[model samples]
Target: MLLIILGLALWIGAHFLKRLAPDLRARMGNSGKAVLGVMIVLGVVLMIIGYRGAEYVELWPKVQALVGINNLLMVFAFYLYAASGMKTAITRKIRHPQLTAIKTWAVAHLLVNGDLASLVLFGGLLAWAVVQVILVNRADRNWVRPAPVPMSREVMAVVGALVVTGIVMGIHNWLGVQPWG
Candidate 1:
């Protein structure tokens, strides 16, 4: 739990460095980009260690029964994840689908897995989503839609989600976490 919390902290803290500490970002940007590089490495390492330290959570508490609706959220998560980084009209319409997807993922997990560690992990993600949305709103960045996503990209997105979902399921033993475990 400590490791998990530390990982989340490092991950979230590193993310906040830019939003909460723009001056620091400017300084780092000015200093030949060393600070940004260090921050990225440190954040990624901490998150992996923290995630690895978390216990295998199989039987989630029964606050809400796992159901098909929850699965819908996961599918939406897939869509958001898929749309990210694509230069298409879909992104312009969705405008931060990835962030929205994170929110959905956190919420869906929270509804299904009612454990302390799950709560901490997903809850932090939920909070991060809120902050991200707020930050985006505050920053007022506009998303311009380019050409529509090629039908192929849509196909690729579905395939990517399946792969990710499958990988997560396959590694449930190592992950100590599962959507349907």
Candidate 2:
């Protein structure tokens, strides 16, 4: 639990730092892109290690799987993720699709995962996502609302997101720990 908390703190801290200190972040990106990249890599590596360390956590019991509902939520999360990327029309409406994706992803997981660590990780992310969107809305000069994109693009987004979501779901067990273990 400690390891998981620490790892998440580091990972989320780094991301939040950028938003809170845009000038500092910009300076680093401008003058030390390579170094910044390395730092990000190291941070991610530590987060993975820390999360793995706590994956064997018996601190909380596993919740029974609601396979059908869980899958449905994941599918919607993927749709939002993919919708943000496609330029067909939806992309023009929202300034940030990926953040929207994160919001959806976090919420979806919260419903499926009933553990302290899962709550911490997903809840923290969801909070951050809300903050980010609020900040962007406040900071941006103009907000454009575009028309709906073509149906084909939505379909493509769904397909693309499904593939990526499938891979992540598959590897999540090996990467973190078992669902019911």
Candidate 3:
């Protein structure tokens, strides 16, 4: 639990350093990017280790029905994540689609896996995403919506997202969680 908390803090802190401490971040310049990348990688490693080591205390009975909902939400999450990098209709409407996707993914996991580990992992990520989005919005007040891309590009992006989602679902069991059943 402590490692997980520390990892979450380091991950979120490294991400927000540029926005929260602009002068300090600017001082580091290019080296700061490398340091941030290392922090992110280390944070993820610690989080995985801590989460896997932590005991699972079920908070609610697992609902098989929520599996379907989780899958649907994950699909949308992947699509939104992909859309964030593209000038699609989705990006035009959603200023922070990647963060929204993270929140959606966290919520989806929470809905199905009501356990201590899941709660800590997903809830912490959800909180981080929310805070990060708020900080990003505050930093860039004048939000200029991107121009709409071609419909075909949007379709391709969705198709790509679907492919990625399918791959993830296929390997879900190997990851120790059977997302399907």
Candidate 4:
């Protein structure tokens, strides 16, 4: 639990360096980016180790119905994630699609996984993303909406998202939790 918390702190702290400690980050220059990268990687490694080691304390009983909903959310999450990088019609409506996707992923995971570690992981990430979004929006007050692209491009994006989702499921399978049976 300590390791998880430490990891979360390192990860979230590194992420907010620019927003929170801009001068320090500027002083560090490109080396700051390298340092931040190391922090993120170390944080992730720590999270993986700590989460696996932590005792599974269920906060609530598993809600089986939510599993299907989570799966659907994951699909949309992946779609939104992919769409964020693409110039598509969907991007026109969603200013920060990647952050939104992260929120969706956190919520979806939280709905199904009731363990303490899951809460710490997903909930912490959700909170971080929410704060980051707020900071970004506040900093960039003039939100320029994306131009709409062709419907065919949007369709292709969806197809590409689905393919990415399949790959994610495959990785989940390799991790021992087979998303698809």
TM agreement with the true structure for every prediction: 0.77, 0.75, 0.96, 0.93
lDDT of 4 at 166: 85
Residue-by-residue lDDT tens digits, candidate 4, 83-102: 88777777888888999999
Report RMSD (Å) for each prediction in the order shown: 3.5, 3.5, 1.1, 1.5
User: How much lDDT does each candidate structure score?
Assistant: 0.71, 0.68, 0.89, 0.88
Worst 10 residues of 3 by lDDT: 172-181
The local lDDT score (0 to 100) that residue 28 gets in candidate 1 is 68
Cα lDDT tens digits, model 3, 27-136, are 99999999999999989988888888888899998999999999999999999988888767988888899999999999999999888988998999999999998998
Q: Which stretches of candidate 4 lie over 4 Å from their true place?
A: none
Best by lDDT: 3
Q: Number of clashes in model 2?
A: 0
Model 4 accuracy (lDDT, Cα): 0.88
Model 1 TM-score, 2 decimals: 0.77
Query: Which prediction has the highest TM-score against the true structure?
Result: 3
lDDT of 1 by residue, 7-102 (tens): 677667767777888887777665635665666577657656765667766556655456455666787687678778654345767777788889
- Model 1 alpha-carbon drift over 4 Å, by segment: 30-60, 63-71, 87-89, 173-178
Quote model 2's TM-score: 0.75
**Reference-based lDDT, residue 125, model 2:** 72
Q: Each model's number of backbone clashes?
A: 1, 0, 0, 0
